[model samples]
Target: MGKLQLVNIEKSYKTGNSSIKVLKGISLEFRESEFVSILGPSGSGKTTLLNIIGGLDQYDAGDLVINNLSTKHFKDRDWDAYRNRSIGFVFQNYNLISHQSVLQNVEIAMTLSGVSNSERKARAKEALADVGLSDHIHKKPNQLSGGQMQRVAIARALVNNPDIILADEPTGALDSKTSTQVMNILREIAKKRLVIMVTHNEEIANEYSSRIIRFLDGEIQSDSDPIEKKDSASINQPRTTKKRDKTSMSLFTALSLSFKNLLTKKGRTILTSFAGSIGIIGVALVLALSSGLSNQLDVMQSDTLANFPIMIDTNEQFVDFSELGPPGSEKSNSKYEEFPEDTTIYAYDYSESFIMHKNVFTDDFLSYVENIENELPEEVNNISFTRGVGVNLLAEGTDGVVKFETMSQNSMMGGFSGPSMGFSHWYEMPKDHQFILELYDLIGENSRLPEAENEIAIVVDEYNRLSTLFLEKLALTEEEYDVTDFVGKTMLKLLPNDVYYTEAENGLFTPANP
Candidate 1:
């Protein structure tokens, strides 16, 4: 017997400063297998009483006993267990998830009870078949008629095989014919379980229910004689069904159910997901753009730096060298008249000055550098030196001639600039002179540095600039001759010092061509 007892049940709500009493001292008892109808007008505490009995809401100052088990010490978890294992709910509005199939709706009770996936699906299909929805098991709620959706709800309520079925207006949304069909299902279910329903229609109540209960103004106006109260005293326990459970709420199960529910409400779920992801999507796009731009800037910087040679200094007072780039970046040379090479004198007189030379760049210095290079963790293939000399270039034609000079300095500006002396020399071309150019940006096409005798690979920057200078010497604009691709087309030859420089009457140096 699905026996239930309530003693002195009290419930109230507070709005503003007033205490609104809903169920004032509601006392009632019920026995098993009775089709009971609760009749009441609006706000007569019928639904509230039903909810309290169903454990959906709590009643203050009440002793509710289910199958002789007092709920006085029952916690929320106990109530939840009662709802899952004992009571089944059927509402007037069906409350079927629109996207879920009839079978899935029935499976919800089992899912919440932590039934195994395979087992729940099988049981869900069985419950639907019992409600004559076996053919529509795969249909969504929206695909069904009002009667069919209500049938699915009934199937769901019965899927757990609960002891007490609390239905509120189960036939309220159906037509007269459909209402009669629903009442038949309820009567059939009441044969084994206790069916307590709330309804306003007196004809349905008087005709279908075995017991009638009337409530008015938060008080029980009438409670009909129990269908068989004497037979219920022997029912000391609720009915039992196999496979029903009081399962604990598992995190994995909760997430799975939540996700399924989300899928049922596709539009709202998609809208909420999109809204939440807006900031994340924006951040990801920003990071992508920033990374791409950073990569491009690194490529540009690498191209600019690759054209120049790497210089290492052993001078103790220096911190860094060549901080500025090529083109107009010449070393500052305003302080000293004499060069460092001239400061070291040898074998001149018997009275010689003692010199304590620190670690400096020398011929034997490279041997020590080689030793250090050998000790490096990475492989070292070759180490060679390319001398940088101070030199100038001349372009001559019928219009006249122009000289492009390279600055050679005497002092280093805290090692922050390249040697003032350029790599080119005015030395005479005796038999053959080979010059190699480091063109960092031209690595993909005709990219070999000059290694053979008399071979030259001129860098594009110097090549284009020299071509522009030759145009200027001819008194012409650069637009007349495109210097964009001037890599392999250029040729060069070395010059002699005496032919390029001459002494003037003022004891100063001058270009020999002028």
Candidate 2:
């Protein structure tokens, strides 16, 4: 019996409404210590056939017999054993673990086969030495050149002492010079192992194999003697490369080499991974804190507020008096007068209270907003609106009172003023101001107003508190303004009116204006 045989193999895959057949009644036989090359163009089912032979994939219909045993009847464990004992695969990408040393990678196949540690190491070292890579046992796959890495892959394949090696486009990504080196190594291995390689390069296939099988439209077009002789003078002749020591190393030797490299570069590796660890920690912390805070806020707000509470304030005055007023003046009356045409406004219909400015509603902007809305959960209910206004703060200088626009809420009031700091105040007006609107949609029943409007008239209570604490502790002043200001202002406009409009004993603010 031949070392491997595929009798009347057929494979198909369901694509859309039809089945696409890849392999069509392919029959092939490979003997021990034979080098066969399957030459085909892209989409010729060469890789799929190789995968089936390697036990990585199952053929729809076939009789795959290896070493006189029928693989068609093999179970998972049987297939695993067959693959472990009979086949070694090398891919075009040289699937080496970048983090592992050359020796470690080579030893992986034997380790997977449950070979003893000492024997695995010895066999891996011997294979590497055969590939002229004994010295690179401690080097990572990335540290070696392309040709050297492919040699490492060959060494890995040979370490398990498998009877067959299946290489798929082994030299596909290498330069012409490096490709020759890789082919020479494969040619040498085929002298003792059944090396079946799939390649598109006809010249490389002819140079290394005694038999060349051409595949077309997923069928074996021809299986015949190589048109070119192995002795043909080709550019890929084996070169006199530097050879390493033949003495094999123990498993401890390889492990020691890896440990030494890790120790020598511990700081760099640790630093590189530090940022990743920090990122994970930050994400965990944010989720934990946000969830906890949200839960507590939900409970507190739900127990106190009704579905809607009466909002009592001057017409068109949405500013929270608690933040803009003094500590004891939370319930103080504002000096501003109401518009003559003003009437009681209902907060329940506030969803349609403000219209979005046409300037801010560009197609691109709407598209972006729509994309963001799409990512939200489907249970959302209410949406809030906000507007931004530029207001000037009057500060008394040494000579005169100077008016300056408040560029940022965190701006240093001490820089432009004397000992007395100029605080911000919100004035009610009948005229609509051209300002940016920040809207918050109520998604869940437990949703609470943003703290910006909840904490009196503060732009963003939490952020302002944090910024004040930071400035106080560090004794620092603002150097640059950030978008955080806009976010804070936007959130202020999105807060529920009840949070800032009603008395504490009256429960939450109502949607009906009083």
lDDT for every model? 0.70, 0.65
Give candidate 1's TM-score.
0.52
User: What are the models' TM-scores?
Assistant: 0.52, 0.47
What is the number of residue pairs that collide in model 1?
A: 2
Clashing pairs in 1: 389-422, 389-423
> Where does model 1 exceed 4 Å of error?
226-246, 249-274, 281-514
lDDT by residue (tens digit), candidate 2, 329-430: 643334433454667653344333343322334569656644543466332222222234444333333344344333332212111111122342322211
Q: lDDT: which candidate is best?
A: 1
Per-residue lDDT for 1-514 in model 1, tens only? 4378777899998999999899999877787678999999999999999999999888888777788677877776677788998999999999987767788788878766777888888999888888888899888898998888888888899988888999999999999998988899989999999899999999999999999999999999988874355565654343332222356656887898788888767999899899889978999999999999997876555445434435564445422222222456653332434456576654433223223334467778778856754686233322333235555555554466655444332212111122222432222211111111111333445555445655533333423333444445435554744433544544343466777888899998886763
The positional error of residue 354 in candidate 2, measured at the CA in angstroms, is: 55
For all candidates, the clash counts are: 2, 8
